[model samples]
Target chain A: MKTVKNESSKGSPRPAHVLQKSRLWLMYPPRLITTPVVWQLGQKHKVITNVRQASVTDEIGIVCLELEGRRADIKAAIRWMTNLGISVEPVEINIIES
Target chain B: MDKNTGFMKALKCRECGREYPLEATHVCEFDFGPLEVVYDYDRIKHSLTRAVIKSRPQSMWRYRELLPVAGEPTVGCQVGYTPLVKADRLAKRLGIRELWVKNDTVNYPTLSFKDRVVSVALSRARELGFSTVACASTGNLANSVAANAAAAGLKAYVFIPSDLEQGKVVNSLVYGAHVIGIRGHYDEVNRLCAEIAGKYGWAFVNVNMRPYYAEGSKSMGFEILEQLGWTVPQHTVVCMASGSLLTKIHKSYQEFMKLGIVAESRYKVHGAQATGCSPISTAQKAGLDFFKPVKPNTIAKSLAIGTPADGFYALKVMKETGGAAEDVTDDEVREGIKLLAETEGIFAETAGGVTVGVAKKLIASGHIPQDASAVLCITGNGLKTLDAIAGHVGQTREIKPSLREFEALLDKENKLINA
Candidate 1:
């Protein structure tokens, strides 16, 4: 029964302050495909960026990224990525039946 | 636990191909990809013949072997078998050779296609020993879950956007289900429901019980095939919410073809969306494999899911089938509703209007050739969302109950026509 709230399911145990985990879909434009945006995000912010799934072509790149950290830090990291022309969206799962 | 699991083999991950027990689970733990139910089609091909299906009752459960239920359906047994209306007048108006409407608006109990999914989900929930069920909906899914859960004597908690239509809200509330109104968009409510479903053990139909719930949509496609004399339509224009219905419809056609029921034929499965929430359509138009999520602002609330779960798959189906996708404005949606009502006398909800509007566009742009035949899936009834067309349908003329007044009014109308 793994819930989304459990941040310690995958990696090393974090402090209680680093509580939030967000699953995001990061779309990289063709120009940014060669850029190490995920590494840059982890270097700049107090967030752990884990790539769950990725498919990169010459035209575009899409990565299912899981970010674990304080809620504000994750939000700030997302804002920074968006500022750099990355389309940051919440990962879509089974939310619709019809 | 049921020893016999019907024709279903196991829940398989769409990405990783890892199999899981057929239970109330939706996503793969390792890769986070959605799980789908795989079936033993060989056994199904032997048993589910056209004669066997024709001998059964006229309901979705007639195709029970293909549905994911272990035993008899205790929920909505009379959910599907909606009409496949040949819209000749609408076809002429849209400049298409032939047009058909898979009218799920008059579906049993719920007056929407959600009844099909809820029926399968609740029945599977009971089979899995779950006493409570829930779902996060824009409107139609909430009504179906509330109604079907009430009928099945299961406790239900339906979460929806607070700003849904009054008719839809009342439809759920009247069933005595706990309808939680979240003051946010559908995407926000969906995120909250994901958290709730993870914490609680309740069977959220579109979350934990999604693979079974989604398989129910195939019944709609099955009925369309059967009603069209066991032939797949050349074009199927389905409105997109999470884009699940369009993909399932394509799957249905493929399943029937695989079973040797329908002769192999080339068909296109098009997708429709409101311009306000046209994520999948926008991506298809831009020739992108992935869609960018958008905040929804559509009058078609039922199809306003900003992040469609099956969007990628829907795009794949369209690309593979040589189908096109289109989106329409709110005003065009209203016009579509009116056009269907005036031409075919079938009043569909906003999502249906989106289907019709997009069908017209696809025909006009020659994406769907003018001579090609098509079927537009009208998923919900218009009466549920009267607010969307309340001020737009035009005003009624007030007249006293008098022969003299009626004659004068007729005379003035006749004079105007003559002039």
Candidate 2:
């Protein structure tokens, strides 16, 4: 039997120094729902984009995604996505500690 | 030895009924439907007798046959079996006949109902060969996860919004868990945790291990019935955040009736929410099938889930059970907390306050009758959320050490000169 992977479970060193992977939810307005922002994100930056879940309607669109790249490149891509009218937010916000 | 010996049938899709192995997967790969735990009732009915359950320890494990865990629970063994107090004074204040309070404020360790779910989730996480457990929590859930995971000796990572209550943050940090503060709303933290779960193979109690985790909530319902002489209450008012607890309690009642634990009777499960972030309650009131997510703006931080994952199921339960949903303003939440404290001597958190406050409205609007027996779910303690009602509860009065000074003060406030 193959062994189960537990590298991350072993309290591995933080990944914040080099490569970074982030899960983001992007909400698109009606006008931008049809636009290819996710496609352009890959073309414009050195990032790997994977769509985890998406819901599209006539008025609004929401997409849950996984983005992997260098920390600086990922930051640039997120800023670009925000400038293009897509609301970019990180995942797993169960606690509102304000 | 066949490792899976329990009566658990399989994990079936809620929408399509497609079966999958009892693994950590929560959604169907084919249809993306949420997977629900299924059990063989015939086998459970034969063994899960009242005497058997009564003979076990008083912790949530007493209902282990109903829970989804396979092996003996290795974590949070002391959780559950909280007091279910009969609130006569609270009932009189609300102009109702009989009222009960399922007080989970005194729940073990973290002192909230979340301990029940975390206990089950961490146990299943260990059984599934995972060494790390994580969650994206509002506040109570983070505290429970941190405390339980510490006792279980598992690596824990808790993510929360940067603006959570100081008490809740301290509760988690005191348990020595790795706490990460995200500079966003709870929904954003939830999304990030989901992504992290996908990339890293840690067991996120509410995300990846959700099917088992949610089953823990049924214990609350079971205890509610068991404590009430094995009878269902006419109405059960629950505080809703992600709406899972309400739906699970409804399921628990149904499960008990199905297993011959209680005589079947008509019962309604009402959901309560704070108005600032009431997606489910708003949808239910508008008679809509879906809820629109909102940016949360409430002092009841624990109940600030804008996009409740189980909102649809919760709405369905409310409709099918002839129940109504209501939301309370932040001011009403404080008032509700004070009402419970003064009348029942139970200091409940804002979520509990929301439950009490919404129950008050439901009674006034004739949704819940004044004479009908009801149970208001007090999910968390007021001490964790003191900031919400700090300036509102009233200031303390100073009295001198002498009876002469006290008499003068009393006479000044209420003149005794006539006497």
Candidate 3:
């Protein structure tokens, strides 16, 4: 619900939720598309539910996600991605826990 | 002159395939996906031919059938047909066979390849009933828009990052464009340009006028194939910032194949980027289905897009064509500039260096075959990005103009030359 700049067990990754939207800006020189990487990551994280991709431009692409898992596990999976040199940003959804 | 009607059907959404009237916008109203210029291959096949095209003047105009501009071109008609130099010496240094350089460094008027796109945009702007051409750019686009607009006798408005290189700023100012220096990164400046385009009727070339503008890039692919004995390359490497060039080249290859001109699509594309500004490449390597946004930090300022507009499509092409994207370091970029100059005698800017540097990396990693015919696109002239190599390009030897002064440094000079 709130952005806290903290990591998982290593105090490097903050909490990440399932069914929340996030983004990653990668620097891989071999490609400019993000779908392949997202598909590849979904294979690793058991909580991943769905991934949809949209083109940003000829030089950019965006991915929308619906993940289902523990917040810590999802955050750890995201940090694992960062360790791969693929930058990811977690965009929080406005929660109304009525 | 024959009628070239293949390019005027309508602009189609790359994602949804929804068509729109021939206009300047690059995105669709729904789903936020980008739009690309669509052509009727059946008409082009009937209209354009190699003998016919070869008979025409040597420029990007040779493929006029595929371009969006209507009627005779009036401004910067000397555009296109940049040289494709064989980099044998550079090839030997990199241990690759059959490497060529598609040099847009000497692009007319302004020194960058942006001239090619801007000329097309201006021509179509005139045809589409617009009198003003504008854009928000970091550097090259500003120069091209201003120069082409001035040549076309139209008013110009160019927006750029406030801290852009003086050389680029001066280049645009000299062309008499109404220059605006926004205090922000290229992304922020680009956002402002989008807002301005919505409010004002000014034809922002990269924003609203992109369909026609992007058609200009197809010439790069056309030239590469035509110059290479009417065959496509085994691999083509282009530096990626906004990812337009990479996708357009892919489209060009497709067009050629569809027209029965290329016979088949065998070209592999490699994208080059600075590590600090390599969002697409990072996504590609991380094996993601979509890109993660980046905060750019790189010496290849020409290609420092933190959020590339076509990054998604560029990635898609890489997958579809068995291509790869890679990033290089700032030091490697400088070395790449020196290497290209020393071996190929092509003193390209930082972005070109990124292509060369990343090409070397891809080659070493066995991504590109040793014997594959590869073309490294040098899109901009070194003069435009002078600041990138100002203190490092050529060695400055202080000496008097005399025989004794000449003889005084003979040993050092000889060793340097021979070494």
Candidate 4:
């Protein structure tokens, strides 16, 4: 399945870049709909796990996700989500350090 | 001096044992598995003793040797030490062998378990050099995040559904938090917070600081075992919203057993969810590996998170421990609350009612043994959700202070008594 792998839980960890980073987060405002908002970016990718929502707001809300999957789906999911009222954006979040 | 032992060791990832300098972070970078604060149990084993903790203070911090903070504690100093009331009557009513109520209803600052977590989140936010902290909450969490942030001298931004209980909204505002009501469900609101946290540096307690904040819930399990003479119960029935508390309590049990604080045993962990929002329980029943998030519609607003962060993990633990999950109706939730209050004098919020109602269901269905030792985790106070039981609690009996009035009332009482 096409998906958007969030560096955090949505998609595959960014191919160990020059920075050799471990985690990244995609954040949004509290909202009802999620995953779909970033559906295109993660179409082929699968979210290994997700942080889902940071807080809940109303009407037009936001959601943050950490996913994993193929690179193609991850890109498409983000593109598709923007059409669904989600302001698709990348986030640099650190959940833990071990 | 901060005791130099494993108790205050650096944080570690649960999915991967990557250790980081103690910072307020939650997710790991490698596989993105959630991180948790791991302790040095050896030091805790040697330092913390029943007698020593009992003599230190009547607070949650008394178990400092087992907690994961360095130096002096800066938050939740007045929390914990809640009632560990033996629920004999509740047991009798449910026909269970043993049931204990971890009555956090009287938790200080606010009467919910959120106080315990928010206290840690705000303090750790300050430690991480953040000037503001925020959260997207169902109701009780909003009340707590606002109050603790205010107390810790940090600007608090809280988001909640517009239709949240008035009591919860007022509670957040009264604490001087920047409370915003969204005109949608909690899941949507939470999505917004995640976005803002990325753009802004303000610490989102449950988002970035979730690892430590969640650790605060372990105190619930620790308190229960400590109150039970340092032994883990065979079965524990806990209320679920985000499923963090349930998973953490189980973590607490394993931690205690590993440290030789308690003997190892196969402890069953039962989860309770509101029928309006029972994704985890429903998934468990359907034997689905993943939880399908739902739009929550329940009077128990505290336990109303449609998409729980730890819902999957909660199911994993329940299955691994040979436990089960159940959901109760709104009517049963109220009855559960009233049943506990009337029978045990413990006024719990709607979540507690859900737990009591479900625990009874579990027993009736022969899921839990009739004579098993169990715990019903009452995570919040009922006063916060008074709207759920409006007009059902009691009615005022008006009477004039006259001898005739008294004589008539007395005659009615006597007649009823005789009849």
Candidate 5:
């Protein structure tokens, strides 16, 4: 099958497959604070990782991370992190105040 | 607009400062920051004076101008104005010079402070033309939303953890609300509701409608200030679930001071939590700017939010005001409940136990100075969480209703007491 370029009505070029962006909060346990997990994630996964905010202490590390890539790759990346004992939650979940 | 919007201006992102229309949406699209209801304080300053509030009926709606509703409240109108009792006996026991109990355990309709938030959310939901309202609650919020929605004649659905106490489950079910029991914890229930809120377009009080819903807690603080003769207490101890109430109470004090309704005064707003689920308190105690979520395992189910949404902001408020945070064990929680009940005749839930227990520790540790005045916010009644204290409270002795038996029991009790 011939791949058609994904484009808007204005005909600007885009990725062949739609890219999805997700914002997440990644919580690292005290032992995982210095693991360079984000670097490893970018090297291993097809997704791009951006750190929006981070607070590191001896006790714990919390990072506001934004991920952009194919949906499946993002899911796999999150699953990998979870397997490593990292807590991954959507940023939207933080909107609830009750 | 055909109806007045009270004094609310718009929903503004707490992080990015972006403004959105006062709608059901609760997060900023660009940054995922929580949106909060912003008010036109200049207008509220003129309209919501002490005289205007005094002339109104005693309810949370008495502060309508500051609440984020489009018009007069139509649901749970009788909520709030719960007594702020002088807790002299409790103060003496806790080693504090003065203390008050904001007794929200008897808040109208529902027996918890959730009634205040539900009233505001439902009122705003009606204005937004929603016919069905729902929420993801631990227990108290479910009870409040169920009861209030029934009285408002709106369809209601409340999702809660399947492991909630039977008393709370019955309270919600008795109101005819569709009470769903999720297999996981409250955070999971809340996650599912966030999706449902988007897909079904129902007014999820703590999800999409949170900005307005959270403003309801300010009433508790406003009442505290007014009941204290319009003066901010030197210290306030509030229990945290998502830590929303603590932050809102701080906001309430700030709003009153900004409006000149109360004189500017330095006050500390301490936070309390169960040790089994104390993300906010742990972070505050560690002097950290953020908190790591933990799986909750505590008798204080109402305050068992492992991943508190407002944990960061709550920490900021506590640190900014020079406040302290503390957590109590399950044993200490029971002791706190017994202390409050034996001293002040107030039967509070585990959350209240956490507050009372923490207040004692804070007072003892000098975080709350021994001589300073304080207020403890009791957010719920113990009846809803009887399971936590069922076997822990002293048992009743079975006695025959005969004079001989009564005399024998009195003699035995007197001997034991004397011993």
Candidate 6:
């Protein structure tokens, strides 16, 4: 997969003027627990995914994911997850992550 | 590293599989994930025995193996080891089988639980070669940072919201720390301080030094377990702000079990919040794993964190333990303060009032079992938030300066009481 850092189309427009990076804490409900949403997000979208922490149970799957990609792609990925009944929050996941 | 230091592994990211040197950094620079203080637990388990812990001074430092500092704590030497009073009177009032108050309102120096965290954060700040330290706080945290920083002789700057109670502001000013009162809420103040933390190299206890600062809260949990004859309580209710304390308390219990210091036992962890700014509790009640941030509007200023950073984790603990989270109204907060003071003689701040009020609600609703042993965490002194219960607690009766007048007043008071 090509790095999303330098995929701007020239003369059309740079969707994100600078590199867009975000860290999120996502909560996946029981029904969506079996789905490979995070794996699919990386393959289908122009994004890099890194999971910091996760605690999965039969009822819920909580994951802290860091997505580095174009702003538009990240938003779309979040929207897709939201549509799947996942809760995504833009948290300052690292400063005091413990 | 000295033998006194624990086997600290490295700063690891919770979101991304990344590792960094154990330094002053707190967040993952690669992906903005929070860094955690990882330890060589196998090594810690070998050295951190109950006997070794018992031999150390009766302070939070006794649990040094779990803490993140590299050397002996030089600051806030008198912090922690707070009295965990078995409140029979309060238990009778709540109609519970047993009750304990982890009374941090009398915590050393600033008289709040913030002393435990600040002590560790500043100790790490000094070790990391930072000569100045700062923090963005509501009230209690500022007082703690100001007082601890002054004692350590480190240059200190405390940023706080302008609307804090006058006592907290005065407490900080008296410590000779540079106090900056931003004319905004705590959330706004925190944002501005984050920007300032980036520009300046000073160690912000809850920002750059957060990973270490947060580890300090584990001591409160450790003390509870140790105070209860090295056994975990059936239920522990902690006041929530950023929600770090609740998570850390839970973590402390898990660590104790993991290290073989305590036997495997089921203990529930509950959280307390004021109705004005209870994002975590509101989410827990709604059966949601995520919380929507709200603008705080409660008298529990110390707990007026609209956007709790650890709300998700706190909810996870609550759900996993089959515990509960509840919030109390401002009126209930004052009543809680009065009930605790009148019943147990422990005058606590508004956050304490919130804890007591929520405990009462949980008990009445049968969420907290009728006979389960429980502990209510009281985090601050009531004198700091005197305004919350000013007119509500009633004024002192005026009496003539004479024995005859005093006798007459006593007789009148007795008649009124009987009536």
Could you tell me the C-alpha RMSD of candidate 4 in Å? 8.1
For this target, which candidate reaches the highest TM-score against the unseen true structure?
5
The residue-by-residue lDDT of candidate 1 on B1-419, one tens digit each, is: 23468889999999999999998888777777889999989989888999999999999998898899988899998889999999999999999999999999899998999999899999999999999899877678888999999999999998877776676678889999998888864444555666666657788898888899999999999999999999999999999988889999999999999999999999999999999999999999999888876778999988877768889999999999999999999999999999999999999999999999999999999999999999999999998888899999889877999999999999998999999
Q: What is the DockQ of candidate 3?
A: 0.03
TM-score of 4: 0.80
Error of 6 at B155 (Å): 0.8
Per-residue lDDT tens digits for candidate 6, residues A1-98, read 23232213322333454445666778777888889989988887878888976878776787878877766787788777767777665545222110
Local distance difference test scores for all models: 0.87, 0.83, 0.74, 0.73, 0.86, 0.83
Q: Model 6 lDDT vs. the true structure?
A: 0.83
Interface DockQ of each model:
0.24, 0.21, 0.03, 0.08, 0.17, 0.07
Candidate 2 has a DockQ of: 0.21
| Candidate 6 residue pairs in clash (backbone atoms < 3 Å) | A51-B15, A52-B14, A52-B15, A52-B16, A53-B14, A93-B34, A94-B33, A94-B34
Quote the TM-score that chain A achieves in each candidate: 0.78, 0.78, 0.49, 0.45, 0.78, 0.74
Interface RMSD of each: 5.4, 4.9, 16.5, 10.9, 7.3, 8.9
Cα error, residue B308 of model 3, in Å, equals 0.5
Q: Given candidate 5, what's the lDDT at residue B296?
A: 86
* Model 4 CA lDDT for position B223: 86
lDDT score for residue B329 of model 6: 99
Q: Rank the candidates by lDDT, best first.
A: 1, 5, 2, 6, 3, 4
Residue pairs with backbone atoms closer than 3 Å in model 1 (clashes): none
Two-way TM-score contest, 1 vs 2, winner? 1
Residue lDDT tens for model 4, B180-287: 777753333444455555445677787777876887888888888888998888889998887889998998898878877778878999999999999899988987
| Candidate 5 Cα outliers beyond 4 Å, as residue runs | A1-23, A34-59, A65-77, A92-98, B1-4, B184-190
Q: Candidate 1 or 6, higher DockQ?
A: 1
Off by more than 4 A, model 3? A1-98, B1-6, B185-187, B412-419
**Minimal lDDT window, size 10, model 6 chain B:** B185-194
lDDT of 3 by residue, B308-377 (tens): 7677788999998899889999888988888998997888889999999999999899899787779998
lDDT of 5 by residue, B229-339 (tens): 999999999999888999999999999999999999999999999999999999899888888898889998888778888998999999999999999999999999999
